[model samples]
Target: MSILKRDQGGVPRADPLGDAAGTTALVLALNKPVYPVYVWFLAESAFQLSLLTALSMPLYLVVWYVSRIGNSRAARLGLVIVGVLDTLAIALIFGRESETLAFLFACLVLSGFAFYRCEVWLSRGLVAAIFFLFVLAESLIGGPLTPITAGDMQNLAYLNITGAAALVAFIALRFPRQERMG
Candidate 1:
């Protein structure tokens, strides 16, 4: 019951993008956990991080795809395509070196698109995909930008928490009240 209207087939046409303010808030919120994970990965080895990413990403995609089966065929198909692209992007982020930051930035941009344009499940799924990709990439790419100091870690945490709070508030305002009430 968002700003969406139905098509001639009686299908609920989805929003072309998400609410601008809401998606922006969600992006900030979703990007929070990357700092700590990046820090932890830097403390560890890139090999371990990549291995972890390679293992976990496929599992997550499978789970996410399975969970979306109840949706309409078109929606499910769209989710699968996005999920596959996301998986490939994640693999590239983990597989390559010195490009984690770039990939993370790209994923975040996609996250913004997902939040604004896609359905709720797709929006949420895209965020999850971005988080894992960023974490894996951050872990592999060790450099000046990577969080090393305690202060940097703390600052990242602070930003993430603030973003999360804002995201929650915006989500509350953005979605239909009846959906939640039901």
Candidate 2:
């Protein structure tokens, strides 16, 4: 009886996007560290600025690629390729100016793949951990490579980690779910 009434329904319905318990919270957390640093100083050096852009832009592109590819496994494989390149790139960033950042660019592309494949906290955590080390390395030893300002580097780290987290969240929410397709 009451079941047929539109106005008097019980639980009614749930909104999926709103159900994202922590999307706004997480996005806020991710954006925090970078904004203040922006006020402190601009990007330290051409090299560091290049490094951040090199890492982020390619990733954004590759994610678009993964979406078109549509198969999750295929996307995972792409991520693997990107990961391998990233490993090589990190080595080069410290090792030499020309090759290092380029290779790291490849790695960021793979990160998109990880975002596509991973759907939970631990998966995202692994990516975050790697990023933490990546930034810490840039801070502690990067001065040897070229002149970059400390404030710039801090901002870079904030942007990188937060951006990466945001990437994972976007991937989780927007990806096509076959289960939901029907």
lDDT (CA) per prediction: 0.41, 0.40
Model 1 lDDT-worst window of ten:
15-24
Alpha-carbon error at 23 in model 1, in Å? Answer: 7.6
Q: How much does each candidate deviate from the true structure in C-alpha RMSD?
A: 12.1, 11.7
| lDDT computed for candidate 2 | 0.40
The sequence of per-residue lDDT tens digits that candidate 2 reaches over residues 45-82 is: 53443443245335424533543444343344444444
| lDDT tens digits, residue span 95-144, model 1 | 33333333344334434343323245655666687677557655664443
Off by over 4 Å in 1: 1-5, 9-128, 131-135, 141-143, 146-149, 177-182
lDDT of 2 at 46: 36
